[model samples]
Target chain A: MASSIHDLARHLNISIGTVSRALNGRADVNADTRQRVLEAARTLNYSPNQSGRSLRQGATHSIAFMLQPHPGDQQYGEPFFIPFLIGLQAKLAESGLDLIVVMGAPGDYQQERLRRVVETRRADAVVLAWTRREDERIDYLTQAGFPFATLGRSRSGAKSYPSLDLDFEKAGADAVDRLVARGHRRIAAIRPSLNLNFAYLFLDGYRKALRRHGIEVDPELIASGFINEAGGYEVTPHVMRSKDPPTAIIFNNDAMALGGCKALAEMGIRPGHDMAVTVIVDTPLCRYFSPALTAFRPALEPMGQRLAEMLLASIPAFAGPQGPRIMREVWPLELVARDSD
Target chain B: MASSIHDLARHLNISIGTVSRALNGRADVNADTRQRVLEAARTLNYSPNQSGRSLRQGATHSIAFMLQPHPGDQQYGEPFFIPFLIGLQAKLAESGLDLIVVMGAPGDYQQERLRRVVETRRADAVVLAWTRREDERIDYLTQAGFPFATLGRSRSGAKSYPSLDLDFEKAGADAVDRLVARGHRRIAAIRPSLNLNFAYLFLDGYRKALRRHGIEVDPELIASGFINEAGGYEVTPHVMRSKDPPTAIIFNNDAMALGGCKALAEMGIRPGHDMAVTVIVDTPLCRYFSPALTAFRPALEPMGQRLAEMLLASIPAFAGPQGPRIMREVWPLELVARDSD
Candidate 1:
């Protein structure tokens, strides 16, 4: 292994300082020379000790995506994140940065994970997803003046940061509107038990839409469950057994909606026939469901790419000539009408 | 941020050498002092410049799990990896090592990914999954003398390495036996298009089982797909249209099996009654399917934990009193009989 800058410089017949500058992407280095040095470095396997290099240069050229394992779900929100990560990684690659996925340990909270990344100087920037209503992770990053971006918006951050969010509030309202248009006055909302920011916003829209339609927002219709299929299955029966049961239900996610459909099947109540159902979808699985669920589709892969671009715009070094821009984009979700609801 | 060893030492009123020794876990340091130093380091967030430290000590205290995105599937084998990662992280944490997930760039091959991890000195060791039949990544790691372990075995490597593999061979044979017992002579197998090691082993077992039963191994009966729902949905019809259509079919994975079931449903064929179905299951979705699928279940979380243990046993530093031992384990799959097949 050509272990150092000296070895790379010697092999390339170049000065050590010139080799260092080229490797660091210094503006002073000519494009041709920089390419040659980088090629040689990669070919000869010259790895500058990352910690040492970062301490001097103040850059790691890596982005950490802090992945919080879904509670009670081993798949870890696979449908959404896989495509999202592919997009994120693809975009980050264009900038010669690597995407480092850091999943928190079991029973380990999000704040601790974020702190570990920051404390270790693991990456120059971090990308956070599954934003909570009052997110301490966001607050901590903001206070540390860290360069970071979020996949969803949060209320706890003191300063505005770059973020890309789907309008869950609109989706919830739209589901209610669609169900109400079908002459259904009793509509229930099954949200995540976890204090996710989107859950609150979705409920907000659900309540507002009911009030606008001259229907009372019943507490009995609003229920929370774990975000997985099992959670959906368990909560569906509970909501159905309520004193004033809903004729329709809006689920937090596809997994929960799938479970709810199963529960409905067990009760001999067919979705879209005996009970209308709707879900906010991210994967193609929703379309393949038995009754083909009526879902709101957010183009996850493209959205992930956009999120990376937004994050890049926020970081001063990556922001190009226009300089850093604190981006806050609330993307719209398209309602895909299907057999269910 | 407590940026260096000096800062940590000064804060604790201890010499820099003592702090360094304690942090490094050198035998010269007393247990009480080591605990005190570690606690202070956590509290103060003292980040030893990792590259500098690793350069001198030859340990990154991190393990890289190289993730290869499924060719057409966006979920990236989520059902397997999430629980696997949780178990991996939990075990690795005990050794004070973090799990660093590294995904290759789009269209980038596995060897390149492995090389990057090694050349950059990103981790002390690596944990690879989805091993190819003749994996160049395995060969490369072996050639470089890099400490590594694999989730599946490979043929290309020169030296025997650590691995934890599911007995796909046995599963394939077992599926054939079960289908034959059900009086089905015409059996079809749907495998991944990717040149994975497991697929080959599965096919080997399948061919042997067919030969043993005096049943001709028809090329037309064996089909390959993209390893996703869409792939399964598309391939199922093609297999059914064969001159000698199969009465029973075995799918490579749960996702593909689900899609195949849909295709069957569209064709007015019930999976369990008209067309028997079986799959190599990894997730709970199989149990929830309309005709709960007949699958082979590999306790993923526990297996993942075992994989970590096996990998740890291979690495000298973390191997403890038993010392480094190259581990090769073949995990079994439990046959779960259900409505389908």
Candidate 2:
């Protein structure tokens, strides 16, 4: 059961080539040499299966995409996934390479699952999406000798990993700049949770933009939570109730910005007139909203395409670099000013 | 290259087994028979080395999950996909089967991809999501003799495939029941586009529930579009603007329900106070929405587990039963009477 080629070669005391020829049924080997190797193999009960040998050689023409559960199940109810997947598939389709989307459970061992994908010859590479600060998936994929690329950069040690990201900082700063240009000084910002890397980048942009405009960043003007519409709706009343409430508000994402508009409308305040709001992710649907939203347009299609290419080029044992390679490209967010601001 | 064992046997006019034993290196065959088979093979230039033929005799032990891109780009910001995947992974984990999630772009040849998955022996079985009316995928998989289970039922001509589905009609009717039980009439229902089978089931449920209460189903009460938050938000005003506006409204899904709640609030109408609302799926985050929300609790986890079992049980030779083996499970709607009741 544990027989090795070397052991069989030693038992026959002949060249391993004769043993290989007999197993592979090569006609070049002499009859006597082939017979001798076959008899020895029969005596040892040896079986030279190709799959086991292929596993040892270590290259599977497949890649895995690790998907995190939508923060609260709202992610699937929106339309953002279609374009992102189309962009990713466009690149992978060119090489005829396969993509495996792996969804990790809350308490499931993501690292172990990733390890199995690589070790079992299931996939030669991986692509990590919705990355968080100090993501365990990145650490494990990096350590497991698998080539991987992330959709977004990690907070602490993502430099070693190849990632494609949007400049959230610039997007955020630009959101503020557009709002300020509209003669709104007391501006409020609805940000994503502080724990996320993008959230912090957005905050930095907001602060920088405010400073450049000679306005101080006030803690009272900042509201934070999940970057969803419900989060925007829930936080709007609190911001409006504040004693010197802002004339303009910036939301972390487009969905939340729509929620903010609804909240203002609920308060009998017209979004574009009495109050102004800006959002990130300038999606096509934004134009359809009652008061079309003014938001930042991140090049999500190119971002997904580049990430797929990087993962495809980084297949196992292909050569130049080992571990995750870090590549950054920022597509400037265009400010789509609509009725909202 | 096209020589078979029978071709060699016919030439010699000897037993096929004698020829097989000769080529297969079996010692039971006479040396003369072995020589004849080899000479015939050489003459014909036969090469029995194709990967597909060998794979047929060996098991790959991997499953392919061909995923449809979420309806559009806005869905990424929603939460439906993450949990469905988590549920799927949990079921696959018990059997130690690896799930290879593949995304085929719209207008791409999905059937060809499925054929390749089988031809290349990359996966032993396939699971197709987003099964549409008159689905070409189901037909292709069936004709190719591949094992597959669909996430949803199709309204196509044949229902010969194995599928795990929820009784969506009952779920829809139950929403109306809950709303009516609370003494509300003139109910409006928002549904997904009729192109999908689930949408029709939901509409049927809505009508049945109305009929049960001795009310006529009004065409004006139904709205159709993409099943997303914005869809709910945008359609609500139209419903409310009706000359005889509905006192209660039912949403196809939770995300839309949340959006409907926001829309009502914007119209200076608190959900529970101004009008009643009910949703389909009871996503985990529904409990955290400002108004909490009243929704039907579809058995997503169990549905996933059952689907996995169906796919695993299917054999390569399975032509499916004479009639569709449709496993329908109806989970009652857990009516949580909150502020939005």
Candidate 3:
């Protein structure tokens, strides 16, 4: 938010470069002039864009990770990002790239923060996480031709972008198949909010699995909310209290599943025995849960490493891509079957 | 990372200001020179420091948050940082200070990473979170006379620095008092690794409370670990199997408490019924725990806000301090009693 270096220079009645040298305290600048420049800078409240100066020389040697809340969700306690970030940074460090995290508020959703960063050229290559289906950010980045990558894929028309995401549809189908094999007729499902593209994609696979087994889809059995502990707690009772309560449940994440277990315990219901439960994405804490969770553990560190590699490779100087290499990666889900399902 | 623009100017047979002007793409610079300068910069792989140019001006208008793994502990899933960071960034935003997060690895512990940042002048003022006692970073920053703040207080001598931390010792005593009042004769405590100042401070309060209650402190009842869910699971069984088992348990954090409860559940032990449980901090998930946890809630957002405020106020230009104003704050913890303990 530097008003203008030109204005500061004009006020000092000096050439812009002399003003720069004076403010920068370069050996060539006079000491008295440097002091005058500092006083003027303080008076003007001068603040230069750090990245602007770096980008002028062609590279910043830094990867920008702009952290933003997922649209329509203020899910605060999802412990996924930190480990993912740590992994990404470790990978980047080998190439002498620093990872600078720029955080954004819920109000600054939809790549509005990223747009500013790109304009300022704060980082050479930007990395976006938790992509949505039909993401506008993906479209904007592709159109602008900015070097960037995402942890999840976006449904953009024919434009190739570097991205990595889970094969959630397959994971969803696998979960349903496993629950059905356990002799469960009535099944309940808790999905992430419908706004996220993954939620619907997951449900689509779930529906196909039910169809394969010739089970009619029951609209009453489906519940949707934020995929956290509270979401599971609230949805469990509604689904269980239905006219035909399901004997089995599938949670979108371990957080919701854990919450479901607590709800079941409160109602004197035993999971895996009274009500079969399955969760996607196993967390370390899940192992300590009673009636141990049947879930999928996505290799986060590897994913992070892969994402960084893909992003680095996509940079024109790195791999010398031909007409923008897609660098697509859809990781398969790994199942860890515990007693819960 | 930038291999010097001065060398580039000498190599190109141009004045330093001309190289700067050309690299920055000022209108006065010739187009041919700008192209030649860009090609040379690419060949040299010169990456300018974003803050270096600003740092010369006496301020970067940036506040750095160096994210490091707590020493001797690779605790990854502490959901505290994101919310705490969000709050700090929000507070800093009002003062026109951009938050730059520089993450560090366990191997780069001590003040190694921070030393590099300081040498680079990456930020005007730095913020350290989750500080340890006898912290080398604190000592170095204090000795260097750098502007900085800590989320937790350090055990440094009379020379004070800006800091805000939870009064864990008081919370530990309060927890013991509550459990003792609930007719628990033998109570257990799970502290963070003794290497951390908090563990001993909390234990100090615990011992004081037990003594106040006229009960003998059983050394076997006190345990320590990484302070995550796994820590609680590992220590719960050992303490429960002791000759004089504890009727009540006070876990350092909710994650450990949840794990402790799970450990009990595995052994057919019901928390609040068979073993009273109290956690030091209340997490959102604690509300759903059956025989719910009694915990102390440290207002984190406000704490972040306060830390930022204190750090900002300590900046000499902002507050015109006589010397370095050593702002210190020890936040009061609020008790949230549920079914457990």
Query: Best TM-score goes to which candidate?
Result: 1
Kindly state the fnat score of candidate 3: 0.38
| Best model per DockQ | 1
lDDT for each residue of candidate 3 in B1-341, tens digit (9 for 90 to 100): 23678878888898879888888779999999999888888787564444455635567777889887554335346566666777788898888677888878656663766875665456788898767777888887877667889888778634467888889899999989888787887999987777567777788899999999999999889888767778888888878888989999989877777778888888888887888888887776576676667888878877777788888888886664464466888898899988876
Q: What share of the true interface contacts does each candidate keep?
A: 0.37, 0.34, 0.38
Better of 1 and 3 by DockQ: 1
- Residue B326 in model 3: lDDT: 68
lDDT against the true structure, per candidate, is 0.82, 0.68, 0.77
What's the C-alpha lDDT at position A107 in model 1?
A: 55
Instruction: Provide the TM-score for each candidate, comma-separated.
Output: 0.92, 0.69, 0.82
Quick one: ranking by TM-score, best first? 1, 3, 2
Interface RMS for model 1: 2.4
Once model 1 is optimally superposed onto the true structure by TM-score, how far is the C-alpha of residue A274 displaced, in angstroms?
Answer: 3.3
Model 3 residue A323 lDDT score: 36
lDDT tens digits, residue span B16-97, model 2: 7787778879999888878878998889755442222224456555567776543532343434545455666677777756
- Please give the lDDT score at residue A245 for candidate 1: 87
Tens-digit per-residue lDDT, A126-168, candidate 3: 8887667777777877776778888876786344668888888
Tens digit per residue, CA lDDT, model 1, A153-234: 7887864688989999898898889999998999998888647888888898888989999999988887788888778878
- What DockQ, on C-alphas, does every prediction get? 0.49, 0.16, 0.20
lDDT of 1 by residue, B158-259 (tens): 656788889999999999998998899899999886478888888888888988999999988888887777878888898898898999999988878877
